[model samples]
Target: MRNQFVGKLVLVAAGIAVLLVLTPFAIVPAGHRGVLTTFGKPSPEVFDEGLHFRWPIAQSMHLVGVAIEKGEGEGDAASKDLQTVKTKVVINYHVRPDAVVAVYRDLGNQPGERIIVPAVHEAVKAVTARYTAEELISKRAIVRNDIVDALRERMARHGLVIDEFSIVSFNFSKTFDEAIEAKTTAEQLKMKAERDLQRIEVEAQQKIARAKAEAESLSLQRQQVTPELLRLRETENQAKAIEKWDGKLPATMAGGAVPFISLPAKQ
Candidate 1:
């Protein structure tokens, strides 16, 4: 009975030793960092992915992910023309692994909710106010870039890196949309009218050119009609009449007058 009791005591001591040996070691998962805190105070040393050792019951591990994350924000703002604008913003960001401890110490773990959201609103508002509503609609890329630049600098101070940022959407009043549509329609109509006018002008020019050519041809024909040509035409007509006539005089004459003075005195 004494030997059996000693063996049980030895087994109890071995179990306690095993527990002590394994308690200090922790396995930080993939894409995470282990932040160490001793006695409720944060330590400057940060642990990367994989196994790490810490004091039992004295040092605690807090895991934070350093992978890429997405954040969205929206807000109401006024344009440079005092038009009401509603904007939705989207951003991709990630925390710096080495600087995460700084993030936890300075800004705490809710950095995204607390920091990025407000920054997006402010940056969007500030950028939106600089451009007119029409300009905002036309130059959306410029607006997105401005917001990105502003947020990048702001978030970098808190250990958040901006990967990509964009202005997802911008909404304005119904009246503005109608006005744009009407303006586009009017411009198209004006262009059509101008094209019609140009076509008519070209047709008119072609007709004038044809008329001038006809007039030039008529003038050239008139210049060729000389007095000698008229006499030659009359002679040719007399010859054709003589050729077709029989070799005899006319039996009668017109009662009004004779074409020529007869040789009466000689008769």
Candidate 2:
């Protein structure tokens, strides 16, 4: 009985030892790289997603995400025209899978706060200083490109790759906004005045055309009158009076002579 009990104790000890030995193995989740460290020193080799083993108590594994992540940052700056400008930007980035060890050794787990945020702030201020406040609103695409280019150059050395970038907002001073509005309104009023002037000119030209047409008609009528036309008109009038006289002169006359419409001499 004692021998059997001793063998069972050995088996239990062996099982516990096996469990202890297995504790050094770790499973790196998907989309992440395992960073190994020995004696608080980061390892040069990065472990890909899967099971990896390290010497127990002498090493540790840290997972660094290689997946794309979003970061947002805002900064206040002065434009080239000395206008106050507030800018916000969003960035998409990821750690180079192969550079996880170096990144971990240098930047640690908070690369977004340590590297990306400051880069965004710096890039925004630098680019904004080159453009006027109005240009920042008008040339938005160009400004965003400038900021992205600057951030790419700054972040690449730190093992962060800029995948995408965008300008979220650009705010200006109240006085500047009011000035732009006033300018737009004034331009609109000027355009309306030009259109009204053109209409008035067209209407005046139309009136002049009508007056000239009436004068031409009157001149034409006057030119048609002549001595022959006047004689013909008088003879037609005398013939009409004779037709209505019933072939007899009036019984009474203003003078002692027969009262009759004198016929015009034949022309």
Clash totals in order: 0, 0
Candidate lDDT scores, in order, read 0.88, 0.90
**Roughly what TM-score does model 1 have, to 2 decimal places?**
0.71
Error in Å for residue 166 of model 2: 1.3
lDDT string for model 1 (146-230, tens) is 8888888989888899988878889888888788899989999999999999999999999999999999999999999999999
Total clashes in model 2, counting residue pairs 3 or more apart in sequence or in different chains:
0
Deviating ranges (above 4 Å) for candidate 1: 1-22, 213-267
Weakest ten-residue segment in model 2 by summed lDDT:
248-257
- Candidate topping lDDT: 2
| Predicted candidate 2 versus true structure: per-residue lDDT over 1-267, tens digit per residue | 999999999999999987775587978999899998888899889899999888887888899999999988777999999999988888999999988987888887778988998889988999999999889988999999998888887798988899999999998889999998998899999999999999999999999999999999999989999999999999999999988887764766877766666699999
Q: TM-scores, in order shown?
A: 0.71, 0.69
Question: Root-mean-square deviation of each candidate, in angstroms?
Answer: 9.2, 8.8
